[model samples]
Target: MSILLIILTIILPPLAVFLQHGLGKDFLINVLLTALGWLPGVIHAFYVNKR
Candidate 1:
């Protein structure tokens, strides 16, 4: 990952996922994860981005 993506992931997980992937399953799931908790969203964003 680049500097911007890492920053976005820490700051806003969903946005990171959106940038890495798009408006699809990963993005939708990241949205939910964010709704649930910031940490979870960040974790999921990292996981999704890894994939």
Candidate 2:
């Protein structure tokens, strides 16, 4: 599950964040980061990974 989430994070950060933490702070942050920079969003999404 963690591996899958990580992969998803790499591919699509917002979706990965939404899957991990739902439509909360992390999700909002992921979207913001994605808008600011793609790599940052990927990193943030991976950081939010529960497992």
Candidate 3:
């Protein structure tokens, strides 16, 4: 993961995944998680970005 992704993940999880992987399952999951709660989205974004 890059610094920008790390920062974006904290501020906007879905956006971070969108930047890395675009509109797909990961992005969708992040969006849902973000809608539910900020922390879950952040964690999922980090996990997705790392892999």
Candidate 4:
């Protein structure tokens, strides 16, 4: 993951993952995680983006 992506993920988790992976399972998961809690979404976004 790029620095910008990491920064974006911190600010907006779902948007960061969506920009990287688009509308897919990872994106959906991030969205749900984001809805549930900010920290989970950030963690999931980092993991997903790295993968």
lDDT of each: 0.92, 0.85, 0.91, 0.90
Which pairs of residues clash in candidate 1, taking residues 3 or more apart in a chain or in different chains? none
Model 1: residues with Cα > 4 Å off, grouped in runs: none
lDDT digits (tens) for residues 1-51 of candidate 4: 678888999999999988988999999999999999999999998898888
lDDT of 3 by residue, 27-50 (tens): 999999999999999999999998
lDDT tens per residue, model 1, 1-51 = 888888999999998999878899999999999999999999999999987
Assess every candidate by TM-score.
Answer: 0.93, 0.84, 0.93, 0.91
Ranking by lDDT: 1, 3, 4, 2
In candidate 2, stretches whose alpha carbon ends up further than 4 angstroms from where it belongs are none
What clash pairs does model 4 have? none
Question: What is the Cα-based lDDT of residue 37 in candidate 2?
Answer: 96
Where model 3 places Cα greater than 4 Å from the true spot, the runs are: none
Tens digits of per-residue lDDT, candidate 2, 1-51, equal 568877888999999888767899889988999999999998888778854
